[model samples]
Target: MSAETIVKKCVFVEAINLICILMAKCSRLCRGNIYSLLKMSKGSSSRERG
Candidate 1:
């Protein structure tokens, strides 16, 4: 009910929000990296067979 408590709660909520956003971004980046690597290897293998 105090002003200090309200401010602390706001800061905690903001931190949690930021953490969630960063995690989502990191997972998307990781997925892109894995997809690209798989594509490159597949291309190389096909070239070798040809």
Candidate 2:
């Protein structure tokens, strides 16, 4: 392949890798937030019942 095509492929690969990393991080953060919210709600409900 030509040098230009090789460079383009490298850039595309790098972009995909970055996007994957970002998505993974965002999903983890969202999961953690949801878990915390659920815990808080459950605690409050139990406290109200008591």
Candidate 3:
């Protein structure tokens, strides 16, 4: 392929990689928030029962 075409392909691949990285980071953050909320609720419920 021509140099221009090669550069375009490299940019496209980089964009895809960046998007995947962002998505993975967002999922991890959401998982952490959910886990913390669950733990808080469990603790409150146990306290009420006791």
Best by lDDT: 2
Tens-digit per-residue lDDT, 1-50, candidate 2: 99999999999999999999999999999999999999999999999999
lDDT for model 1 comes to: 0.98
TM-score for every candidate vs. truth? 0.61, 0.66, 0.59
Model 1 shows how many backbone clashes? 0
Best by TM-score: 2
Model 1 regions more than 4 Å off:
36-50
Model 1, 1-50: lDDT tens per residue?
99999999999999999999999999999999999999999999999999
The TM-score of candidate 3 is 0.59
- Error at 17, model 1, angstroms: 0.9
Model 2's alpha-carbon lDDT is 0.99
**lDDT of every predicted structure (CA atoms):** 0.98, 0.99, 0.98
Off by over 4 Å in 3: 36-50
For model 3, where is the 10-residue window of minimal lDDT? 26-35
lDDT of 2 at 43: 100
What's the best-to-worst order under TM-score? 2, 1, 3
**C-alpha RMSD of candidate 3:** 2.7
